[model samples]
Target: MQEILRKGLEEMIMKEALKKVLPLVGSVAMLAACGNGGNKANKEAGKTDHNGVAKFNMKVEHEGKPIKGGELRYALVSDDPIKGLFNPALCQDQSDQDVVNFMFDDIFIVDSNNHLTNDGLAKYKVDKDARTVTVTFPKGAKWSDGQPLTVDDYIFTHEFIANKDYPGVRYPSSVGPLVGAEEYHSGKAANISGIEKKDDQTVVLHYKQMNPSIEISGGDLLSYVIPKHVYENIPMNKVMSHDASRKNVVGNGPFKIESLIPGESVTLVANENFYKGRPKVDKITIDVVSSKNIISEMKNGNYDIAGMPADQYDAYKDAANFSVIGKPAYSYSYIGFKLGKWSNEKGANVMDPNAKMNNKKLRQAMAYALDNDQIAKKFYKGTRFSANSLIPPVFKEYNKDTPEYNYNPKKAKKLLDEAGYKDKDGDGFREDPNGKPLVIKYATMAGGQNDQTLALAYVQFWEKIGLKVELTTGRPIEFQAFYDKVEHDDPEIDVYSAAWGTGTDPDPSGLYGEHEKFNMTRYVSDEHTALLKDISSDKSFDEAHRKAAFDKWQNFAHEEAFAIPTLYRTGITAVNKRVKYYDLVSGSEDTKARLYNLQLTQSKPVGE
Candidate 1:
């Protein structure tokens, strides 16, 4: 059972090689960002609903004849600097993903319905009877480095993440379903026995049991392929910072990394050998710009396309130079309470029954005290709205209109009084149930113009309900630092506010499962576990049963109050009129808007 431990003893000595290569945190900082796609057809802007959310057109049509070739100047709207982990397996930060999207393609294409289609680099066939998924890559596919993209590359991607020494957060949920994955990950098996290679371009994944989750990208299947010839010999710990992952990264996507400036910018040239065909543009440059400066930069024609921050939508909405294209994103901002600590040895969350914020009524009260609607209207204008459940409405098939905590100070105070949290010290703030002073430390990321204002407003909301909540570190933390503190369960943080970028699959297990490191709140419950399993279980093949499970989980999570949904975003992009083709509709089946088909009406972005 422990044979795997001995197989990698020599690799332990090579772990220090990463320190010589690059500092771990700095390397991660170089590789974090976001990405979105759009459609080309509806030239008109969308209308705002009563919830203050503007329903933008999913498709847009621009008038212009596409010219031969030019450069695309893209901007990643973020106040945080990019962390350079360019590898698809290691890059999880949305900001870094924005850059990665230009260089890497998914192994299988997922359509608007969140179902996998045979329109990508490879085709797949799932056999429930055999509990195996077979992926076949066509012979012609080649990496940007002119190397063959074989089945071993796909198999290597899973092995890299499942390796015990690998330090990424994707291990538990991403590859756990593969048979022997746990044994390989826990040092019990020499190698994953389930990843079988039939030929150079064919790989079969044998799962312990197949479920409906595998129907989408976020399932046990590897979403992106890595070049095995590049990183097979590198130490697992050093792979993230290796030149192959950063400066000289290679992929089979439409673009190839031409130059990278660490945390600031990246320039990519067309991959002539791209499976989809050579990209229409000569080169593409992605710059990391502060969200506050995005609007102004778009006005000055400094960008061909830029992610427009929700808070700045009003300023850019009517700008003649660019059009505001948007669609509902599979993401939500939420406030989570630390109810337990993660047990690394157990590889599971250990919920503490006596944690300070463990009282259900206290959490409920805090949720009720938040005026998310007001924040949506005041700060985001018509771009975002208060969220009702962890499952964003974009997953229309599963997301239900469940009961939610609206701004109700009266109910909040009532719940607090019933829970025995009162101002026992004669101070306005409430005391714990034991008559002790209660203070909740909150942490939020620093970004955009209204970030601080919104944080202060949340603090004030809790104050109004007699709960004393203060910011951790006395202020909002930087993007990387914020996640570092949250993931590590920093003692100063009792609560935190953050957003989640969901995958094409509607399963929440990756984010909230007991063994998931992405479950920052470290919450666990018997019902929660069972509900999650039911959502992905074989029985979930029945549409009614799956939806009921999702509905039940949302209600249960809401009632538990471990995580309170705050806002659902409208992903808004400002595209210059000179751009001939660009898409904002995520996970669409249309290939015309892909980089390979991108065109420019003019040599440079032009302001109206």
Candidate 2:
């Protein structure tokens, strides 16, 4: 009778496991069917939307409408002050780019749906080889100062970022595919040979090979064109050192920088001569505040919009005069391992040689140990989802066929024992062959309360398996410095928590490609590298072969256990409902704070 009971219990547990896995499979299947149907419908209609350009005969009624001016006060959480007005090439982390996006425009703009949309910018085409791309500036487009927008501006930005003398502010991933970008940035080449001005309004780019979809989209959204006539004579080294030049930067956008008070706020006024037409709102003000102060300001009506973290949602969800907008953000949290830094000069690994963590099997086992669903529920209040793959489910190419590691503590212990870590000393803790406890340092940033709480929970989770973990936190700037060291492969840490904002393109090359400077894990394999290269160089966007290649890449990343994906959180925004005359764009769903299509309602007072 006892044997029979044990068998019955085992059967029940197996059924429970199947129930858990079935939902994830069903969700994926439904998503795939929807995506395939959309594609088929578009193809059958003989036309499709490219980026944000729609095929339907929809009219833009507000294009020639009268402009209504008003002041928009935004609440922002910013650490570093605005250091320069240049594109991220001068100071990447400073909140200045937010101001720049309002003041100046890029050659190609990305709409809320992650599609390339033409603003004042014009037509772009790629050659059959995919090596050369040409961009043409729209006629009548003018800078804020009324100077004609020209191709020379795009050429200047390309050359400026590729210049060795300039500050290393651009993401290396942005310039990785340009033909001469690496050599120029490395100081090996005199100048970039990839960028050339074909005429007064045309600029051409040459790449080493065809780039992945993400790289192309990033190039479009990130490469903000600068005024050549204004900054051509300025020395590159002194670019960030001059306040007058940085404060009064010129651009071809709907607004221009009016004033920036250090550590306080930045104020902007609409550009009367904006090429697309003047913006409806008259002024925009962004006030920097601490995370602790964001809620109070929002409640008091001192701020129009605030990006509240997931943990704070419950506290403010039922608040009067406020509505929480939730949408999937490309950002995801993960735990990375320092793979190449395991060995020391004595030919001994500083970590336990017999630790299952040293083997990929052990790492995958740990991933299986954690109950991601429980973490999402108890910690995030069910506002997030467990992420099993590097790419989020929103992307079409994400592979659902790959097996996900389910929560199974017994399986984790079994794998650990198989890899030689055992409780031989009978001390109730697993130990290596040398009798040392299996300990790891888990480093996280102390920038906010959420990070602290999450770190504490992770520590507790590891402790349950007889693993000793030390949690360390540091200031945001100091933490970023430590992260940079890990990216360069000089890891002083064993494990660390990080968040990656996946770009509009869902490709994993930036995180998994062998040559990627952002691959913090130092994890590389020949198979992975080849697949990344193939995807990056594939230009046939609608080809079945390209889709298959991308699917393969996603599948490989899921099986490798390169990193432990924690959760995918939605970007939440709280906005005053009184403000009207704005249409939410698809990609802008993360935050309702975008100024692109915003307008002041005629019924409301300007200062209300």
Candidate 3:
């Protein structure tokens, strides 16, 4: 639960959004064969050779018996300071979410395969016949502040999110299936009729229908509940800025926040009142480490654990003192084309049939112009793979039969030629069908030098196919500014490159739905809408039917090319040999529970 919840509830689209901060590092390092400490983590070794890819171990099996009561130092990689929005409901940045995970735990248990079970803090029973799920919180669970975890706290979370004055990015769509969530969100209903509290420990959720995604942690079926006693009186809009949301935040997880220097670092100690037994480690300290210095810092034994950036994996792959763990990340980077604008009045996307990028052939041609395969091999050293579909490979069941987009410059030129984009002005670049200059304004986020190089490489790929793709403001925009322009449907951006940490659930509707703000492309169509419905409809309860719908959407989305999948990444973490009993294989659900058994073999990490 800590893994997925560490990022957020499923389907909150982000700018690849620091989905752990390991993906943003730049600079190249030397490569070596999969080494001892790293290879021992996996039962089967990953193939490795010059110009070939090697897979790291998924878990660290350190030697020696564990000793108790040692501090675990963690590195938070980022270029900017964390915003310290500790509340999950209001926090949008994944970097901040990583910090909050130590003190918070999701209600559902996510298994190794990312499926949610009812074995965590809260237990629930889904009544298909009645279209409801009744949740029961064990009476003994208490927040760090010693307040009892109750049904009122659970209900207050939903009420706060649904309040008309709430100022967070989490939409009430997860609860839209509820009886009166729409009315509550629109300020029509005083309370959600679907969320009924039967007792102090139980709340019954009345839904219009049930879908398979509910078991996969979708639709916010079971999530962490904030202490109602602490946050009930705060104005909904001002909740994030209030003291309770920041320095005074409270949660029912295994750890409690001790102190924090906003945007710098945080110190945490074991939570004696945690529903689970106390954590084995005495204390934990997490510090914000710039991506530029993290690898060197790790070499100097300044940290016990840190996420390894894919581009820098080669440099750190041979570290003798640390074991590297790798896994298929629940995220992907994408290039989205602008085809329409979001309509607040209609509460849906309004397609611009005449939009510059609305042409299917044009979109396809642009997608073909991207040599993502070469980019992955050259820039990411095969740690990142060219994405074939929006539903990443992490979702094996649904990702299997999707369309593939490979590099084909000739095919790209042919598509453009057929679309009537020709160089009538005798310039190297092609002109639009209307014979006007075809200058595509591209918006992308700024990052390290290698990031700039990768961005420019994409532009060069477009240039080779005779498309004029220029950065939005002469260069990649800063993170916040880039999203601001894209979210507002800035006309200057015809296309943009960004990423999404596709949470634990495999549903893409939240990111692509007509009414979703995360649908930055603003594309809307009956065929697309129907396919999305098919994937999440009541009929999707049949696994085969749901998978088939997913396949159809993948094919349809690929053909539409409104948002072209760019790269599916591999997430790797380096842990000091001194740290014992740590594994990334367990999905987010097992994050906190693992800490209870975690120990240190030595007081100081290796290389100290």
Q: Please name the candidate that would achieve the greatest lDDT relative to the true structure.
A: 1
lDDT, each prediction:
0.75, 0.55, 0.74
- What lDDT is obtained when candidate 2 is compared to the true structure? 0.55
lDDT value for candidate 1? Answer: 0.75
Give per-residue CA lDDT, model 2, range 280-367, as digits (tens). 6788787776555666777777765555555454566644544444445555677777665322132112333433345776576667
Q: How far off is model 1, as Cα RMSD?
A: 9.6
Error of 1 at 376 (Å): 1.2
* Residues 139-183, model 3: lDDT tens digits: 777889887888899899888877877776566456666788889
Question: What would the per-residue lDDT of candidate 1 be over residues 29-71, giving only the tens digit for each residue?
Answer: 1111112223332243546766546767644445678788799
- Sort by TM-score, best first: what order? 1, 3, 2
Taking all chains together, each candidate's TM-score versus the true structure is: 0.91, 0.77, 0.91
Sliding window of 10 residues with minimal summed lDDT for model 1: 14-23
For model 3, the run of ten residues with the poorest summed lDDT: 25-34
Question: Residue 330 of candidate 2: its Cα lDDT?
Answer: 54
RMSD value for candidate 2: 10.5
Candidate 3 lDDT for residue 359: 91
